[model samples]
Target: MIVKHGSTTFLKVIIFLTGIAVLALCVWLPEIAIRDARVHPDTAFFLIPFLLCAYGFCIAFSVALYQAYKLLTYIEKNNAFSELSLKSLKIIKKCAFTVIFLILLGIVSLRVLAKVTGGDDAAGPISLCLMGILATSIITAIVDALQKPLKNILELKPEND
Candidate 1:
């Protein structure tokens, strides 16, 4: 009992820290983007579009994080194998897919911008977007894998009861 409670506490702390960092990134990204637009005349044209995509990504991220928080709460309450846990995982998967799609779109746009400008300045952001895609895809896969076991447990629950 003690070990289980301790683990839950640890997971809660991790979730809280992750949520704080993501929220901070949400706030910081736009400030730096606006500053860059002011400093670099060439990038000014892309500022609004970039900001809009960033906002979209942030929204998806926040929703996923909220789902994670709920999932964690369910686990703490010893309901990790319940239908609600599976539902939360499904929502997280959808959010990850949305993030992946958005990042891929951004990558294409960045490539086009680079080609038109005849420079590789967009390379850095393209690389970042690629990394984001990789990370979110992995998260999506893991959440998807988690759902299978939860579903199995849920199936057994009704039979056992």
Candidate 2:
């Protein structure tokens, strides 16, 4: 059975809490492990950029979470066609677009940073991941845009049919 809006609201809160917890862990890890650099200096350096990417992901996730939240609220109130759901969907779309843009920017920045830091090795994974994200986001956004209006129309009741 599909979870209802209220249940979804609870899941959204869990998502938020989990996001916050992961962010906090990232922030705390460096300090907590600073003294263990005997074999993990690289871990610390990587953590900085890891945290950056995590925050970027968190931003995207927040957009999605809010969209879910608004959609759930609309479903619960029997007013799914209202502007709030649309607004939330628009925000989600914009956030997805921004994520794609930021991924491109990150690829460029990573290339520059790699050149400066003399580590061509690190660029490969980042470039691969960013390309994947960009491709997926573009496809997902297009599909969502195409199907959403149809979905909305179908949700309407046929008069005296």
The TM-scores, one per candidate, come to 0.86, 0.59
Q: Model 2, 86-129: lDDT tens per residue?
A: 66667667767766766765666666656765745655768686
Best by TM-score: 1
lDDT of 1 at 76: 79
CA lDDT, candidate 2, residue 157: 38
Quick one: best lDDT, which candidate?
A: 1
Clashes of each: 0, 0
Residue-by-residue lDDT tens digits, candidate 1, 20-130: 887888889878987888888786887777777777888898889889988888887877777899999999999999998888878877887788778668878888888
Q: What is the lDDT of candidate 2?
A: 0.64
Off by over 4 Å in 2: 1-10, 25-57, 131-143, 150-161
The 0-to-1 C-alpha lDDT of every candidate, in the order given, reads 0.84, 0.64
Q: Give the TM-score of candidate 2.
A: 0.59
Candidate 1, clashing residue pairs? none
